[model samples]
Target: MTQRLRFRTSIVLSCFVATNALAHEGHDHPHEAASAPQQMVATAAGPEANSFVADGVTYQWKHRPDLGLQPEAMVAAAKPGLHNNADEDPETGEVVTVVANYGLVKLDQQMKSWSLVDDQDPHFAGGMNSHGMDCFTIDGEVYYASASTNTQEVVVSKRGKVIARLESPKGTEFDNPGVNAYYKSGGRFVPCDVVWVPTAKRLLVVTGYSNGDFAISARRVDGAWKWDGVAFGGRIQQGGPFLTGHGIELKITEDGIETVQIASRGHGRLYGFTPNGAMINLNATEGQYYAQLHNAARPCNLDFQGDLTFVPLLDSLPSTNGVAPVMVLKNFESTGSLIPAEFDDLQFMRHMHGLKTVRRDRKLFAITLSWRNGGENGQGKLNDGQIAIFEAVATQ
Candidate 1:
């Protein structure tokens, strides 16, 4: 007689007990929900071939648990760094869609959910080559965010080509020749400096450099790849209306776009700008505290919504006196700073190289992950790494 394969058919739920009546037995494990899953992969077991960059440093990342390196080559080659990996819909708990490298040759992610992801993913096509730059997806299309603050480019995988170029006002054909109007890198620095603007349908890059003395400038986002608006080397910084490259952090929303800054010097400030270009103070800045930079820099970012802004204050006080970490203003409510010393990956037990938050939002957050453990050709400390999710809450 042949035996039939049997799997559990019923889902165990809670028992119902009537008051003073026959008690109904309730099971603890409920049916798995329909949406995404809430999971956190440890540093080592995560995707291989991952990169997280912070303040000019980069780190390698993998799943917290290496699913058992079958072929050692596959183990070393697999690296999926962090890039807005997690999401928490006020409706959903905590879920993350990780970016990873399947093999040493390409990039993708395994969306960890209720069930183990097999060979398929919701956003999986094939693989996009990242050319050593950070890889991420804007809307299921692969895009790479370079480590550069003033110049970068984004290539849409589906488009099968480099559709956009992100650059500061240095080499572009713009009318500017003074210190105040110089390119951002030529003067200051910015944290998530350049990115693709899907709304305006063009590449958007922000600047705040010190080639001059720390200033802000954005690419001429002309709505269609040609309609450049107010091209100002003059980006606004934290605290007051200073034209610099740092505009806290840039974010897109329903109302408009928002840029923020966090400060260790005086009062913090955030700037609210329209997608088309206009400013209005939203009274979201002003979180004065005493802190110092220890080893590395702190990361600052902002999330803008209509008139509401959520400015982040980060990279507390540094301990060294080398290249003094700076925090600049983006508006009346936003500020920018390198990820401070405490959060520096160099301080981690399994310290990879660079792991800094490049950008963030209520639902998604980005980190530039790298693996140059040491100075150049793989000489640093990290043998393995996983994404470290921090606890945070945003009020805008």
Candidate 2:
């Protein structure tokens, strides 16, 4: 059964609330009781069915009810050896997908179960409190972004072995490549997202909410990683980069023009910029779209296919009719309105937190993370989350 969500003009501020209260305090530091693992329940036939279609998209979904995953981000591998050091399925000889939860988790092709990559790795010195934010693979090397404000380093691993560690750049210049100041001030890096542009040989990192004015950090990695410079808001005084940088994506035009898209969560808007820091007009009316769309809230992780952009609204507030978790904007290059996509009437979809596009067997798939129901850490009592996968099908 599909339920239509009603759109309204009155935007709720509650939708933009931050989850810092539940954020990881520091690496290797003892904390209160951790969230309990979810019980592995038999896949139900009702709303929890394994397959469903929505908005002309057919999806094959799976849930690990036994794992309590906060699912912050993920990196998909279509074939073995592409991401060196990845664990292989003994039965299939294929590389398993890597997901960022408390640490790194490997998901088999079945997607119904998962296992920790290496909890003993010194890189994950935080143990269960280690918050893995984002991940990317390049040149057979996998980079895991550890948001540990205390450690504040990007752990580089190959074939499941810890190899190198990229520490946050140390400097005070606005253009220096480094983690957000919040992390330098004994807080978490809050690294919301990371994107590697092979064409330019650069890595882009965005902070969710940091102390300094600059939120986006870019580094050049030709043969060696070096601070390329930073941009987005340019300098702190201009107040134009990002209010709360949450998600980032790199778009290259047919003419070879590269533009960086950022999800400014605090301002409820999305901004575009050149590789350096100049802003690109998003053609949005009223300066931004999120603030204009009452049905939309805090825009988070974004994935781009051609000109269409898929943005997940990570707001927990109930919608006027119900919660509309995802939004698709057509003709995003031009001025286009937000189109809400229903989550197959799954009531718990309102708790979704992350979004990423993956490929398997040469087909594209969209994956979303649903935090344990209630809220972070199950709203005080620990609980697990759900990983939903949808196969993108052409609209007929």
Report how far off residue 261 is in candidate 2 (Å).
Answer: 0.9
Q: What digit string (tens of lDDT, one per residue) describes model 2 on residues 1-396?
A: 111111122221111112233323211112212222122111111121233334435444433234322233332211110111122333342233333323355655544455556543644423212222445556655554333333444554453455555555444423432333433355334454556555555566665444432444545355555444553342122333455566667767666667666776543456666666555655433433232222234566566654456565555323323443544453332122121223442344443445555556765555555444333343653323445556554333
Residue 17 error for model 2, in Å? 23
TM-score (C-alpha) between model 1 and the true structure:
0.39
Q: In model 2, where do residues sit more than 4 Å from their true spots?
A: 1-102, 109-113, 118-122, 125-152, 163-168, 172-189, 216-228, 232-238, 284-296, 316-324, 333-347, 359-364, 372-384, 393-396
Estimate the overall C-alpha local distance difference test score of candidate 2.
0.42
- Compare the candidates by lDDT and give the number of the best one: 2
Pairs in clash, predicted candidate 2: 28-126, 84-159, 85-158, 85-159, 85-160, 232-241, 233-241
Q: Model 2, residue 13: what's the lDDT?
A: 15
